[model samples]
Target: MVEIAMRSYWNEGPTEVSLNGLCQRAGVSKPSVYREFGNEDGLTHAALENYGHCVLAKVLEILAGEDIFAGKIRKIAYLAAEDGAHESGCLFVKMRTAKNQMGEKTQILIAAMASMAVDAYANLLIEGRETGEWPGNIPVKLGAAYLHAQIGLALDQRARGEDPRVVLALALCVLGLTDAQSEIA
Candidate 1:
C-alpha cells in the first residue's frame, strides 16, 4: 500500500492523488490507510521519505562516489535528464514545487531534506577543492547552493518534457562543462 501510494505520488503530483484513490488502488481500506499512516500528511511524508531512499539516494550516492567532482556533477545531470526512473519527473522536485500546498509535516520534511542536500553538496565541493578538481576561488557554500539549484532547474526542465539531450547539454553547460565533456548522454 505504501509502495502504491509512493508511486502514485511520484507519477502524479501529490495534490492529484487522493487518499481514497490510494486506498482503492492499493486494495486497502480507508481506515487501514489512516491507521497505518495517521493522515494524509502522514501518508505524504511516508511517500516522500520512501522516494528519498529509493530515488534521491542515487544522487547522494553520486556525491559520495569515487568520481571526480566534474564526473559527479555530470552523473547528476544525466540522472536528471536521462535516468529511466525520472522519466516521469522527480517526485521530490514535484513535491518541492508544490510545497506551498503541502501539509505542515510534509513541508517541514521538505525543508530539512533540501538543507541536507545543500550540506552534502557543500561537502562534495570542499572535497573537490582539496583534490583540485575545481578551483578553490569559489566559495564552497555558494558553489554547493549553485549546484543544487542547477540540478533542481534541470530536473524541472525534464519534468516539463524538454528533450533529454538538450537538458543534458544545458545542465552541463551551466556547470562549466564543454560540449565534449557533455557527451555522457
Candidate 2:
C-alpha cells in the first residue's frame, strides 16, 4: 500500500489523488485502508515516511561504504537523477512543488527527508575533511550547504530531462577539488 501510494503521488501529484483510485491501485478495500491508516492523509503520510526511510538508508549506506567524497557525490548525483520509473517527477520534488495542497503530516515527513539529506552532506564533508579527502580550508557548514544545494539542483535538472553530470560538476566545483580528486572518486 505504501508503494502504491508513492507511485501514485510521484506520477499523478497529490492534487489529483482520489481515495477510491488509490484503494483500487493498492488492491485493498477502502474500509481496510481506513482501518489501517485512517484516511487519504494518513496513507500519504505513511508513504512519505517510507520514502524518507529509503532516502536516509541510501545516504547512510553510502557513508559507510569505502567510497570517498567525490565518489559519494557522484553516486548522489546519479541517485538524484529522474529515472524512467518516476516519469512525472521525484516524490520529494513533487511534494515540494505541490506543498500547499499537502496535508500537514505529509509536509512534515518531507521536511524530515530534506533534513536527513542535509545531515548526510554535513557528515560526509566532516569525515572527508578529517581524512584528508576534502580541502581543509572550507568550513563543513559551507560544504554542507553547497552540497545540499547542488543535490537539489541535480534532482531538479533530472526532473526536467537535463543531465546529472552537470550537477555533479557544480558539486565538485563547490568542493574546489583538484583533477587528482577524480582518483578518489
Candidate 3:
C-alpha cells in the first residue's frame, strides 16, 4: 500500500495526490491508511523514504559491479537519464523542490534522504581516487558538485522533452570521464 501510494505520488507529483485517491489506488480503506500512516504528510514522508531507498539500492548495485570509475559514473548517469523520463524528475530532487510544501519534520527527512545519494557518490569518487581509478587531485566536493550538476542537467532536458542521453554524454565529457576528442572522432 505504501509502495502504491509512493509510485502514484512519484508519477503524478505531490500536488495531484490525495489520501482518498491513494486509498483507491492501493485498494485499501481510508481507515486502514490513517491507522497506519496518520495523515497525508506522514504517508508522503514514508513514501519519500521508500523512494530514497529504491534510488540508493540502484546506485549500490551499479557501484558494486566490477567496472572502472568512469564506467560506473557513466552507468549512474544513464540511470539518472532514465529517471528523468518521469515528470517530477529524480525522487530526491523532487522532494527537495517540494520541501517548502512539506512539514518541517518531513523537510528534514527529505533532505537526509537526498543527502544519502550525494554522499554515496562522493564516497565512490573518493574510493576511486584512492585506487588510482580516478585522478588523485580530484576534490570530493567538486566531484559531488559535478554529479549534482549532471543530475540537474538531465532533469532540465527531460522537462524540455529533450533526450537526456545527450545531457548525460556531455556531462561525462565535462567531468573528464569521457574523451572529448573521441566524441568528435
The prediction achieving the highest lDDT against the true structure is 1
Which residue runs of candidate 3 sit more than 4 Å off their true CA positions?
82-88, 136-138, 180-185
Lowest-lDDT window of 10 residues in candidate 2?
A: 176-185
lDDT tens digits by residue: candidate 3, 1-185? 87887787667766668888888888899988878988777888888778767765777778767777667776676666665335546655656777898866678887776576567778777877777766645578677767766766676566556777777676556555555213421
lDDT per residue as tens, model 2, 1-185: 98888777766777777889988887889999989988777888888777667654775688667887768755665566544543444677677667777888788877777777778778988887888777756787777878776666666666676775566565676587654335323
- Which candidate would rank higher by TM-score, 1 or 3? 1
Each prediction's total of clashing residue pairs, residues at least 3 apart in sequence or on different chains, is 0, 0, 0
Estimate the lDDT of model 1.
0.80
lDDT of 1 by residue, 56-93 (tens): 88899999999887788777777877888888788888
Ranking by lDDT: 1, 2, 3
In model 2, the runs with Cα more than 4 Å from the true position are 82-89, 136-138, 178-185
